[model samples]
Target: MIKHTPKQQELQNLQQHLLTTLHRLCPVSNGAAPPPPGEWPTTRQLAESNDITIYQARNLLLNLAGRGKVLVTPGPVNKSLRWYPSL
Candidate 1:
């Protein structure tokens, strides 16, 4: 069996919650809204829409991407990344 630290457990819980929220906000669908016309939204946009801090938004997006719930692409400006819900 495997072991999990308290911090790890908390992180897992947060990831689950973020996944649930994302699904509720943007249900997965092939015909759903395309990511913007060109590029995806920056971390700031995701945080603003989700009402979370930038750090939280980044973590949430990364988690979602890891779980295949969202697609992440390189941003056009700066070295920041963009996020789009996977359909």
Candidate 2:
């Protein structure tokens, strides 16, 4: 059996909430066709779309990435990191 600390549980809950919010914003399609690869969106874009702070967006993406639910790509020099939902 796996054991999780209190902090881990809290983070898990936050991740779930974030996933739900993300799905509501950008739903996953269910059809014969799969989503295209390399569809990373910047944190700023997500923040603007969801009316959230950039910090919140970045943390959510990082937590999602930690759970293997998204991919994080560091942008070019001095650019903000971009995040993509795993398809």
lDDT by residue (1-87, candidate 1, tens digit) is: 789999988777766665566555545566756645245557776567656788987886787788887777754445667666677
- What TM-score against the true fold does each predicted structure earn? 0.58, 0.54
| Weakest lDDT window of 10 consecutive positions for candidate 1 | 32-41
C-alpha local distance difference test of each model: 0.68, 0.65
lDDT digits (tens) for residues 1-87 of candidate 2: 899999988767766655665566556676433333334456776777766688877897787888789766755323767655555
lDDT of 2: 0.65
Check candidate 2 and list the clashing pairs.
Answer: none
- Among the numbered candidates, top lDDT falls to 1
**How does residue 46 of candidate 2 score in lDDT?**
72
